[model samples]
Target: MKLLIEGGRRLQGRVRISGAKNSALVLIAASAISGGEVILDNVPKISDVLTQLEIVRAIGGRASWTGENTLCLDWSGPLEGELPYVHAKKLRASNLFLGALAARQKRVKIPLPGGCNIGSRPMDLHLKGFHLLGYQVSMKHGFIEARAGKIEGNRIYLDFPSVGATENIMMAAAGTPGITVIENAAREPEIVDLAGFLNAMGGRVRGAGTDVIKIEGVSEFRGARFSVIPDRIEAGTYLIAAGISGGEVTVENVITRHLQPVIAKLQDVGLDVAAGEDRITVRRRGDLLPTDVKTLPYPGFPTDLQSPMMALLSLARGTSIIVENVFENRFQVADELKRMGAKIRVKGQTAVIEGVERLYGTQVRATDLRAGAALLLAGLAAGGVTEILQAELIARGYEKVVEKLGALGAAVRVAGDESGEPGAKSV
Candidate 1:
């Protein structure tokens, strides 16, 4: 797939944010624990999500799209054997089911998960947490097998604040027979959304969105409907797009509190951002000012938005330094932006970007999901046409990207798309 984008167009319009992909994936994986008819509303229509639904059906669970954006999951039938490796290996969230399946089934085998190659995302912390939950976990020959009978909850102190490990351990403890306390847990909003979903399904989880979380095992489960929170990453990407395009754009269906760090960072970059109850409007009229940024966990700048911010900073007035404390390979997009005539230098985990007055569009590749977004933003601001290959990777995260950008008056079109149609209609 290729994306042909014309440059120097100001994006001005309102774009509604989709459901959080991180939240939806884990919640769908966690839905396997209670074996009830779980209704997930506002589910993002993305490729990773479809892959998760395939895994659910492969494991003897029932999943169907009840609405355009609603998914119903029911896991009442008997499930056995290894998870389909073909589907599981395509998603990093597939490993989350190790804890969920371990709690429900005595033994289960699943392939090691895979996803964007942004960095090394090992499962050592997850396995350590599982061991504390009474499951013997091991990796052999590219596969992980966890086995235990009548799993019991216990205290787990993570070595780091890993969101996947925290969610996996929480799912493992949801159906056990005792209290499980997780120390140094991830303080992400998606964690809070998972806790809310578990409680709605009769699992007791407290203190999510904090460093400590408590999950008390329950014996009974029931069907419940829940809506996921808005995608803050997607909203942040669009906000940065507005700043880079020097336009006035409002993103709807977002939680302003969740965007505090991004909003502050954008203001530092010279974009005028206004926060409403459920929307944020970004306005920029002139050249942006360069500002330093660092990627951190919750309550700090998100690593997911680091690439898009780099794209915005490329057009800034001076030098900008970005310290990536999360993924080591997060600076991979710097090279792609440089192809568009941006001045960037990468050393280890830090990237020093020298803002240029203008960028000349050229061809680039999307190394990963966020990198795709960064390239798209650069294309919008470049002076000539920008061609981005592997545009399909962008749909794995963002939903209706071409259509959304087109609605905002961006001159972009898809070519050689997999779908018979010539746009992001598949999204």
Candidate 2:
């Protein structure tokens, strides 16, 4: 799919945020361990989430949408140990099923998952975590298989603070016989949300927003109702959209505390940002000032927002530097942005962005999810028309992106659809 964008219009008004995609995917997998009906609220209706539901149903589990944003999952039926690779290969989150199904079925065989090729996502850490939890793990024929004679818990130390490994290990440990401890665990807000959901479902998990996490195995789990946290990345994207267009806009349904890194960076770029309990407002004045950014783990500038920030920096007065510490090949968007009249140079994991007076809209392609967001924002601030190919890729992480952007007063729509009207045929 393609997105036809009209540039140079300031996007203003309020855009409500959706639930975190990263959190929802893992939480949906965690729901399978309950062995009964689990109700999840604030779930985003996106392609990735829908694919997860399909995978669950394909394996004999039942999942459906009870309401607009409510998902009801029941795993009472006998679930297969292996997920159909056809459905699993579409997303990286499919790997999460290993630990989830391992606990229920005692053995799991899942294919290597695929998603945005931001970097190398090795299964070594996750495999090691499973091994520490008394599961014999192996990879053969491009599939990961783990089996355990007796589910037991053990202490595991991750070489890096990998979020997937942490969540996978936590789920597997939650149903074991003993207590499992994870050192150097990921401290993202999504991790806390997952831990909260596990606890709500009668599992014992402690210390989620910290380096050390403790999971006390329980013999069984029951269905529970939980609400996922707001998507901070989505909120930050709209906040940057406001800054790039020199407009005053507010994003609601956001937790201010989860956006500290993004908020600080926008303020450094000469934007006025104010936080009220659960919403944030951003406004741009004169020319934006350049700032240095380094993408780190939680509590640092997020790598997911790095692309959109670069788009805003493209119009700054001076030069800005960005270092991506979380993922490799993240600079793939640099070449595409330069096609839109931005001066950006890439070297290894660092990118140097030189600001220009203005940008002219041109044809571009979305290399990945965040890269698509950067291009969309740039198109909003550029002059003339901007045609973005592979626009459907953005739907993997964002919900109602075109609808929300149109509501914010940006003229964007699906290419070659319905009288070229904004929000026409946008999926």
After superposing candidate 1 on the true structure, give the runs of residues whose Cα lies further than 4 Å from its correct spot. 416-427
Which tens-of-lDDT digit does each residue in 106-148 have in candidate 2?
Answer: 7999999989989998999999988878888889899999999
Q: Per-residue lDDT for 1-427 in model 1, tens only?
A: 8898888989999999999999999989888877778889999999889999899989899999989899999988887557888998888999888877876765778899989999999989988977777777789999988887457889899988999999988887887789999999999999999999989988999999999999998877777889999999999999999998889999999999999999999999888989998999999967799899999989889999999999999989999999999999999899889888899999999999999999888999999989999999999999999999988789889988888887898878886554533234443
Q: TM-score for all predictions?
A: 0.97, 0.99
RMSD each, Å: 1.9, 0.9
lDDT of each: 0.89, 0.92
Q: Candidate 2, overall lDDT? A: 0.92
Which one is best on lDDT? 2
The clash count of every prediction, one per candidate, is 0, 0
> By TM-score, how accurate is candidate 1?
0.97
